[model samples]
Target chain A: MQETRLDTARIRAARQVIDPIFLDTPLYRCEALEPVLGCAVSIKLETANPVRSFKARGTELVASLLAGRAAVCASAGNLGQALAWSGRGRGLDVTVVASRFAPAAKLDRIRALDARLELVDGDFDMARERAAAIARSDGIRLVEDSLDIETCEGAATIGLELVDAAPPFDAVLIALGGGALATGVGHVVKTWAPGVEVICVQPLGAPAMTHSWHQRRVVTTDSTDTIADGVAGRRPIPAVLDDLLVVADDAVLVREESIVAGMRMLLDHAGLVVEPSAALGIAAILEDRDRFADRHVATIVCGGNVDMDAYHRWVGARS
Target chain B: MQETRLDTARIRAARQVIDPIFLDTPLYRCEALEPVLGCAVSIKLETANPVRSFKARGTELVASLLAGRAAVCASAGNLGQALAWSGRGRGLDVTVVASRFAPAAKLDRIRALDARLELVDGDFDMARERAAAIARSDGIRLVEDSLDIETCEGAATIGLELVDAAPPFDAVLIALGGGALATGVGHVVKTWAPGVEVICVQPLGAPAMTHSWHQRRVVTTDSTDTIADGVAGRRPIPAVLDDLLVVADDAVLVREESIVAGMRMLLDHAGLVVEPSAALGIAAILEDRDRFADRHVATIVCGGNVDMDAYHRWVGARS
Candidate 1:
């Protein structure tokens, strides 16, 4: 398991260059959540950053190494915001290829940050393919978010912070999308404290990574359907899946209902306005508190970019 | 003006004892608010703490000095939550006297933190009188939030962080309540960057501190009415007023409508779910962006305890 793209040295060095604003985020226990989880749950709030997501770390890292070249990526969501926010400051040109279904609020923010948006009439995966093709045709760098080792290394700073804040946690629950965040944090925790458990959380509707781990190969789902849009993946990146295999100890699948509830619980108990994808960790813990009982658990509340109306509808519907 | 309470040395020392969770809050540029405010605005989010307010720093510091002795406070608000949160871990008894009109959501949190709540059938001012009377009759330590110099020094850690962050800022707007946070942060900014302007913000309906500063004495309002309940002070503590004179360069009064709009603006722009009182700094900047044009201004988003209904009323009113 020699990580060429994100070795110990590379991950450590990445810390020097990733947006300083993305580093040293607040990591503390939500006391009200502690009772429900039956453990001391220390959560690192990645929602406080410019993009209100951990994508800023990875995107900033990519921008720092772009050598002034134009870059393009496909994201209907958080990744686009990250690219837009980080790339604009570096004076690098960025174009995000998004599906027609991308939220208008997200599109507005991406445009606000000076990133060009190219909307493709297809599903997210199709839009991603078009983005890669466009990058190849135009001689621009394409950001393969989950497969980029540099991106993973950049996100490892979160693990670095978590380890430094409180070592020897019993378990860490990370949301599983393309497996970038999960593997990045899992790598650090496994390297630093080998005995600790690293768990990945995914929506039951989009369990590509979960099935990949179970079947011992990268598996793509037929159709992805989940309210946690950030973690809803229909396809798995092979390299990221392999990385997850090397670093993660377990995976958990959660219901969309629980995710909706978890988002509300987080808002009510912790005063954290995180999106459903970010609430997956808490959703996982809430799904089975007995497993994490009396253990010190660490999770990342990774994003808060949900639109005001959409959030109200989701949370209000549940309430 | 010789400062006895919040000198640099004491402020530094207070950081050591206050809950680690309350220190090193996220201070970064809110790029979205920059266009509206007409400057580079660096906002320190004080809402990330357990109690969702900057009061944790002050209360934790005061609790550190109490050495397990019983402490009582008059607050149906942030201070009570802070005392209950910081005191519970230290095995210190905390009693909160709340006015009948105090928000139930806040009272519920204070009670959840293991603090005893005594309801007084009157206004907030009457509740404060009862708390003072109870402390005297019961021989319990009274935690007079604004009057306690240790609390001021404790809250000064914010100043410490702010100075370390973006020093030499042209202006800093702090919400003026009982004046502890304003004075604490103002003292630090003024000490480190003497040329920097320190402006305090108060609700137009509750301009006691602003009027007191103008009169060079404590000012009492006949009737205090504002939606920004956290900063709606009917009377100013003399010592806090004097502290303001030493540290603050100016005080600004904002209309309640502007405060509501500021709350919506902050939520829409910064993804920060802060309360009306916490929105005062941004409210001040929005009041007269021309005055702060081209300045490197920093403001604290000091609390986030707004209930779901209240948050919707404020944020929904705009969107």
Candidate 2:
């Protein structure tokens, strides 16, 4: 198979250029998870960063390269905050178009990072269209998640940090949304340590990435209803779709119920209160324990955006 | 004042001797928290370790020095698990004396780490008494938390890693129990960066450490009636009490209500499901936000051994 992973050397450079806050995060063994999953699980937590997500890495590199150019983008929350925060260092101002109904905490973070917010009445897709239109009219560059090479290369820094984990991991599980995070991490993992398998996990509610990978083309779902807002995407990013075809060894879809269960387990056992999307990796492992039994597995905990009300409601429903 | 902090040289040496799992934890700026508290708050998360606590650092160093000798210790939970996990490397079998009423999840973790469990019929102090008796009869060493210099030296390694933060913090907040974690961390901060203030946090329900600091000697309380089991010691360790006089600048006692509030905030904002004792630092901050306002402050997030039901009840109470 012709593999077109992110440039290995560029990833190394990106690690140096990106914001240090996202660098060298905690990659520790979740002791309770080992017995439950019947495997040694090392979690690379992205929540420790200033942005509380891995989005900062890619955005930091992208903004640094923008070189004072103003950029317009659409995001539910994480990417917008990353861009706004990283852009400050490079004098690249950001105009983020986001859903009016987005979480207050995320919206507050973006604003605090000094991003100018354009609140749209409709959902995430509508926000994207508004960003594109604003970019055209205002003459600012429009950056989309999972579609840019600089973004993916910057995120590949996860590969650099994972080297520190004792009893090196054999396989990696990552939640696939627009595919930037998975492809970036997979690219580095495949390049730095060949034969290490990369598995993409997608929510059953937001199965665009998984569907597209299987069909060998882009896939669009009617709507994404997953509580994991970070990985809930309706349409597949074409560039990321192509990237995953080369880098992703396999993909799995997990139920929303399993996502809730995974989130609860992580809270109770691992002491992490991550977004439902972050739970997708754990959800996948829990859903199919036989496939991963006794394997040295690692997963990227991509975000920690859930609030108390939402967290309580999700976990409380099961009880 | 000729301060005898844990030999700064020994802390450097302990880094090489201790278990690797306890090193290089995530220390990052909690951006959301800064805005709320009106200060720059950097948190050193110790809960990321294999045992989900900083106790591993101390025990690892202690066990390594023991050279396969059997040891008996009494713990509420975190210390026992840390000893059990770290001792496995040095072939030091551990006998943990725990309260019969200890949390099932914590007890299970200690047992899983292959420690011999002795559940005493009374409270934590009674368990300590039982452990002392066991050590006397078995001719094994009885290692206490704060009395041991090697253990404190091991935990001081956190100070080594905190140098990575961009702006130097002016103050540090830590939860004090038997005081191994606080004294060790304080010892490093005091020796290396003398001006940085060390503030110890004790549960209002368990104010032995704070009371002892005021009295300039050991203090014993009738009962420790707080939800933060990790820092609920009825009696202060004498060596640590003296260590606090030189290394610590101040001590604050926080109410249980604030701990629940602090835990909720970390869950909602920082994405950490920590022990109520770990919440004590934030609780102290919450209890007196004005005192920390505009200061570059740091806190040690010491443990995350909370069970699902306890977590649900604590955070769920607010909703």
Estimate TM-scores for all models: 0.94, 0.95
- Output the lDDT of residue B292, model 2: 89
How well does candidate 2 score on lDDT at residue B183? 80
Candidate 1 ranges beyond 4 A from true positions? A1-5, A35-39, A317-319, B1-5, B317-319
Cα lDDT, all candidates: 0.83, 0.84
lDDT of 1 at A133: 98
True contacts kept of each: 0.36, 0.58
Cα lDDT of model 2 overall?
Answer: 0.84
Q: Model 1, B1-319: lDDT tens per residue?
A: 3563567888888878887888888888777788777988888899987788899888888777776789888884889999988888887899998876666677888988889999899766677898999999999998887789877877788888877764456777898988889889888878887787889999998898899998899889887888777776677888888888889899989998889878878877777778889889888888898898888888889888877677777667422
- The clash numbers for all candidates, in the given order, read 0, 0
Model 1 residue A63 distance off true place after TM-score fit, in angstroms: 1.8
Q: Which ten residues in a row are the worst by lDDT in model 2 chain B? A: B310-319
Instruction: Give every prediction's interface RMSD.
Output: 3.3, 2.7
Q: Clashing pairs in model 1?
A: none
Q: What tens-digit string does per-residue lDDT give for candidate 2 at B56-88? A: 888988788776789999999988999998887
TM-score of 2: 0.95
lDDT of 2 at A189: 74
